[model samples]
Structures are given as structure tokens and as C-alpha cells.
Target: MPVAPAASLRSVRTLRGPGPLGAQVPGSGGAYWARLLPLLAALACVTRLPSFRWPLWSPDEGYLAVQARILAHGGELYETVVDRKPPLVPWLYEGSFALFGDSSLLPLKVLAVTAQLLTAVLLASLARRRWGDGAGRTAGVLYLLISIGLNPQDAQAATFEIFMLPCTAAAMWCADRRRWGAAGVAVACALLAKQTGGAVLLPVAWLLWRDGASRRCVARIAAGLCGPVLAAALLTTPSGFVFWTVTGSGAYASFTGSELHVLGRGLVNALVLAGACAGIVPPVVRVLRVARTGAPELWLWLASSAAAVLLGFHFFGHYYLQLMPPLALLGTAALQILPRERTARAIVATGCSCAVFLAWGFLAPRPDLAHAARLAEAVESRTGPKDKVLVWGIHPETYWLADRAPASRYLTAGLLTNYSGGRNGPQVGEKYAVGGTWPVFREELRRHPPTLVIDDSRGKPYGPDRVPSLRRILAEGYRPVLRVEGAVVYARVGRGGEGEGAVRGG
Candidate 1:
């Protein structure tokens, strides 16, 4: 027989290392854990790396980027920019702007990736402390892979959750180890990062109590929870109050009593949650079955903590992303009970597959991109610097690309009519109605008239539902300039015998 080639042997050697297929390899040692970390991290970076240049910023991201630009230009951090998010996210974006100066999306996305990696590392360490190196490495690999696959919205650079997640994980780990002071500081930093950080506090408190800590210890934990608030106050008291009180309250309040538009969105979120629990539950059941009860209290604390956070709010899908790290650890610990390799492998494979789908969805092509880009280009080609642009029934992504000032209104009648709620206000004829019967929007538009109006046909008011408003605008002397894809741009036209000044487009 011919001798096997050296290159083929080298390929075999590489495959035996901790790559994706390495899980099938038989041996376990320090070398395995050592090789696993960088391999997982590299995989995490490679999967999400393409999203850095995708160029289609979501509405929230576009608005945050605009806010960041304002901050970089020495504008007031909070007051001048009126987004509902806490200041931390915008501050991060502003920092990116300062460093990269509109270079690419990498700076922003890299920040999130880095935070995710830290979360994975912390989770691994936490797993090792509670279980063993094998369990810890498994949890770490699971976290890195799942997080990449889940593609949490904050998976992007300016994500507040990404920053807050690691802090929360660290706090849980510290609390589990009875390191109260470190846990407190970590929780405090989490709170400073985002309001959702507050949800984990009660869970931490419960963990401390279960650890046989005295009532006095609980009080100290409460004080540590307060530390983040105090730190935030040191920066600016009123802003800090606004952060916790106004912004926090308003964000949650907005979610209640509103019918979600895309039914698919909620379904996808539920599937992801179910998938995460699937990874966690079998292991947990197996552990309980085996009755290996050392540190049962810790597992109970973590489960209760996760449940408390999940139950406390009506959060969107991304909100649940933070729960994955702790859940994965708890799941892996539970897996210790099952001596059967086949069952464990199946569970891990199922969880990993679900995660991959979630991550892929985040960077996938959205139908909104084409319409948004066309609207942006249309406005940019026509409008002067002195003119402003108002997008109705559309998100801020379009305006972000237009390089023109956006109107200050939160939502338009067009948006309300097209989206979740139907038109509830005064009719501007049949097709359009003001959302709250607020003529103030129309008055504001007339007072500082926009040079062009770009209406997205596929957006809202499908077919005859849009005609009345288009006609009313035409009656008021606006002429159609250009129509591209589903978008139509209208420019102001002079009335008969009227001076050129009568036309706003000029």
C-alpha cells in the first residue's frame, strides 16, 4: 500500500483539536480546556463578523447613531437627544464615533462581541467553580456558540444589554461564591448600564439568603444594589433619576396594552426561549433524578432568579438574552446527572442548532431595507440643508441615511394607521387621520414645510386606503417628483399666477 501523505496526517491532527468536530474526540485534559477557549472565541467572531458591514441599521440603531453624532459634536448627552433609552448605550456609540469617526460598523459590533466573549469567559469560570473543568468548558462553548446563534439585537456594538449582561453574570457568579461585596459592585454596574439590570437584584438577594447568610448580610446586599444608583447620581443627579424613573418606566409602559404587529416576531421569540429551556431542563431533571444534592441550594437560587426576571416584565425577545448564561450553567450542572453520552449529545446539539438560527435571523435581509434606502436617496437628492425631512409611517433608519435633520415627532399618524393601532384621530379625508386628533403635527409641517414628502406605498394605507391623503396633498399644491419601488416623492408646486416664493421646493 502507498504511504499516507504528510498533509493528510496534519489535517487529521488539526481536526482532533477542539474545533467543532473536536467534541467527538475522546480525551480530556488541561490541553483540551486550553485549546477550547480561543477556538470558541474565534468561531464567535467569524459567525457575526459579516454583520459589521451589512449597512442596514435598524431604526433603534440609526436613532442611537444620530444621538451619538450629536454627543460627539459636543451636544448635551441626554437633554438635547430625546431618545427613550438610558444614557449608557448612546454614550457607548458616542465613544465609538470619537474613535472611529464613521469608519464602519465594526467598532460598534466589536464592542458587543467583546462583551459577549467576557460573558462566556465568566460563565465558564462560574461553571468550573461550581462543577469541574469539563462542565465549565462545556458551558463556555455552549455560551459562545449559542449567543452567536441567538443574535440578540444588542449583539450589535451599541447594545446596552451586551454591556450589562457580563456585569450581571459576574454578579451572579460572585453571589454564588458568597463574595457579597464583589457581587454588589457588579450588580450596581449592571444597573448603571441598563434598567433591566435591576431585575437580577432580587435573584441575587435570594441567592445570598439561601447561602446561609444572616439577615444582616441581606441588608448589605441591598445596600450594594443601591451602589449603582449612587454612582449614577455622582455623574448628574437629575439625569440619574431620569435614567431609573422616567426612561425606565416609560419603556416598560409602552409594551403593555399594545398589539404586536408582526405575529412572527413573538413566535420567533417564544421559540428561542423554548429552545434555551430545552437545553436547561433535561439536565436539571436528570440532576434531580440522580439526587446528587451538593449545592442544590445554589441551583435552586439560580433557577428562582431566572424565573423572577422572566416573570417580572413584558420584555421583547432580546430581553431574555441575558438569562441564557446562567441558564446554560444551570443546565450543564444538571447534565452531570446523566451518565448516558447519547442523551447529553442530543441535548447539546439541539440547543446549539436553535442558537445558530436565532443569530442568523438578526443579520438576515429585512424587507424594509430597500424602501428605507430609496426614501433616503430621494430626500437627499432633492432637499437643501435648510430644509427638514419628516418620515411618516416609517422608522428612523431612512432619515439616518438622508443626511438631513429629522423632525422631532415620535410617531406619525401614518405610522399609527399603518402599524399596530388603526387611525384614532381626526380624518384628513378618508386615507389619512391624525393619530390623536393632533393638528399640531400638520401645523408644524406647514410652519416649517419640508421640501419633499416620500410616501412608502407598501408601508401602510395599502391601495385605496392611501388615495385620500395623496389627493389632499396634491390639492394643496405638491407635485409628484419621483416614484421608486414602493416609495413616492412629492415636491411643492406653485399655484397658477403665484410667485416662485409660493413654491416651497424652490
Candidate 2:
């Protein structure tokens, strides 16, 4: 047989074989991917393990876990939980809890880790199909590293967003191969995962429409859009499924431009978004340039993915995590196109390292778990077993720590306090009252009494004009029984009817 042309050999090697020119020559394709994929998976697992033991559960995670527990106990989804988010995430957690028995964070953590690995694998497959196996492996390895580096707390198993990256990758791959049906299924899975996934369909349809005026392309996009609705109806119960259709308008309406102290928090959020985008820019630009010439399909995917993320949701950092893997692959593609020089490669490597370090150091700290735990214990010790504990202007960690049923209407003042300069704390019987004042609190106490009230005094100061509601309660019939490090527990005196119970700490 005649030898292959030099250009053909180079193209084959760059796309499928080993390195750019003279890197390690692969003996076979299967063996190379088999070895590389596992190593990448292991690296991904190691980075996320630190989060498993850390007492850093966000409000979303805490709420989802509670909802999952309720579902496990045969309660309906939205009716019993009444959160603004969709039900798929809670259902996933419930399934995990059923299998693992809920003793450790292993189940939830594993779910995220597994999803990340699967995402990496799908990305590699997509790249290999387009550029060749070698390029695909490089893309896969880069994606694995980026996913670990940008480990958003929302990437945890308890949220629907974790499914976004994998579903997006699968959809792109199917579309690239002209397998419309498979692409539709992937898009449908994405939609059921989160509304942002639905936004991605627009970019996908644009890409498909560009390829041809074929009726097949239109059919595919329609199928993808309908997939989520059909799946929801078939998989979820009627009573528990209402959350799928709920628009969460109240949740969005509550975000009033992050005014007051919230402005400080908003500024911090802005900086984080800027840094994340900057870190991924070199790679994103590279991928866009390459796709403009070589692979239009990949270009469409990147464009659609970015449009889905930026235009779809309010700028939450975790919402951008799904976009990172594709950005990493784009970076690898950029590397392939650049002049092969040590200095250029060194600059790229340094930029990536700095970005990863900043993200981990500045963005990933576990906030206020210890303080919340201490407050929870103090409240649990002072309150009766049957007494309901209401946390106003407090972290949800208090509920997790105290093992008490949360009040129907929690004051999210704590979230606002961090952003504002004002100091505030929740007062006794405030949730039972209408305006959370003395007269309203008094009437609420007479109507539906709580045996004990826990006041969190650890936060910012409420100016002279805004007196703590608990102060008035102390003047009336409630007396401070115990004051812990950052929290105070008040007991109902002569008027009390309920008995206190033993406190247990997990």
C-alpha cells in the first residue's frame, strides 16, 4: 500500500492519534482514551472531596435536603415543601436518600462528582468526533480540570443545574451527527432539568435551521421542546408535579435590585462574575475563532450555550459552571491553532492557574456554619419539644442545626443584612405577628403561643430607630433564660403552658 500523504498524516495525527507532532505515539485509540478518562475522573473526584466534610451547606442545599426528607416520608413535593424551585432536584435527592440511608454526605456529593465525570466523558466524545481522538482527549482533560476548579456549590447533587452540562454536551453531539431524534431527547432532558436549559433550545434551533431548510430540522426542535412536558407528566405524580409548571414569579419579584446593604453583596457578586468571565475568555475566544473556520456546529453550540447562560438567568456564579467545560475545550482548540512555542504555552498555563486559584480562594469559602450551629443548639436547649422555632433574619443553618420544624414564613432579613450596613436580629413571635411589631406580636402570642423564642444577636446593628422586636417581648411576658455566644433564648413566663424538652446536637 502507498504511504499516506504528509498533510493527511498530520491531520489524522492532530485529530485522532497522539500529540501535535512528536508527542507520545498512541499504540491504539481504545487504550489511550481508557487510560486518560479514568485519570481525569480521579482528578475531578479529588478536588470536590474537600467540600464533603466542610459544614458549608447553602440555603438551597439545606432546603432541598429537607424537602427530600419530606418526600421520602411520603409527603407531596410542592404542596409540602412550598419552595419556588422546580421539583426534579428534590426528587433526585430523595432517590439518593432512599438508597444511602442519609448518614453521610456521600450520596449527594457522589451524585455531583458522577455528573461531572459523565459531563467530561460526553465532552471528550464530542471533541473526538469533530477534531479526532487526540484533540478530544485534550479537550476532555481540560474540561475535567475546569469543572473541578469552578466547582459551584450549586453543582452539588441537590440541584437541577448539575444535569445541564451533560445534557448540553449530549445535545450538541447528537446534532453534530445529524441524529435529530437523539438530540431532541437530550434537549428535552435539559429542559426538565432547568428553565435555562429551555433557553438553549433557541440557539440550537438557529444552528439546525442554518444547516438546511429540511423538515427534519424543524421536527427535531419541536420534539426537543415537547420532551420535558411529556417526561414530567409520565414520571412525576399529579399532586407533586405542579412545581414543574410554576413560574416562580414571587421569587423573581422579591429581588428588588439588591438595594441598601444588599448593594455591598451585589458589588461582590459583580466582581465574581467579572473574574470568572475573564478567566474563561482566552479559551472562549479561541473556540469561537476556530469554529468560524473549521467547525460551524461547535460554534453554534458555544454561541447557544453562552446565550442560554447570560440571557437566561440573573447572574448567579453557579449558573455559569455548565459553560466552563465547553470554554475549556475551546481553550484546547485555541492551543492547537497557536504557534508551538514554550513562552506562549507558559503564558496560557499561568493565566489558567491564576484563574483557578482566585476562584477557589475568593469564591468557595464556607460561610457561617459554626455560628449557625451554636445558635441552633442554644435555641433547641431552651424550647419545648412541641414548640415551633421561628428564625427571623437568620440563616437556614439554624433550622438544620436545631432539628426543629421551620416557620412557614421565614424572614430572609439575614441575607439582606450581609449586604447592608444595618444590624438587625429576629424578634420573639415576629413570624406570628403581621407587621412584626410589639402590638402585633402580643396578639400573635395570645393566639398561637410559642414556648420559647431564640433571638440571633450576632448580626449587624439595627439603627436607633429600629428596635429589636425581641426587646419588647422581654418587657412583656417573655424572660431571657440563657444567652449563648451569639444567640439568646427567651422563655414564656407565668403565662407559659408548654414544657421544655431535651436538646440533641448532631
Listed per model in order, the count of residue pairs whose N, CA or C atoms clash below 3 Å is 3, 6
Residues 1-506 of candidate 1 have per-residue lDDT tens digits of: 33245633432332122321112334564676678678668756754564564664355676676667656766664344444445667777888888898434568778777787778877777666555566667777667655633443434334666688888888877776677877888887777676667666665776676566687777777677676667555654466357534543332333333334323444666566666455556656644544444344345445544553454234445555666776676566555544548346745675577556655655466566666777787788777765676565445667667766654343333332333222212322332332232354455566776666655544444322555543564457566656667565666675232213322321
Question: How far out, in Å, is residue 431 in model 1?
Answer: 19
TM-score of each: 0.72, 0.71
Model 1 lDDT, full chain set: 0.58
Residue-pair clashes, model 2: 6
Q: lDDT tens digits, residues 63-146, model 2? A: 666566657767665444444455566677788879987434467777777777787787777666555556566666666555
Query: What's the lDDT of the predicted structure labeled candidate 2?
Result: 0.55
Model 2, poorest ten-residue lDDT window? 419-428
lDDT (C-alpha, whole model) for all candidates:
0.58, 0.55
Model 2 residue runs over 4 Å out of place are 1-29, 150-158, 210-217, 230-246, 250-256, 259-280, 283-300, 303-314, 340-367, 383-388, 409-506
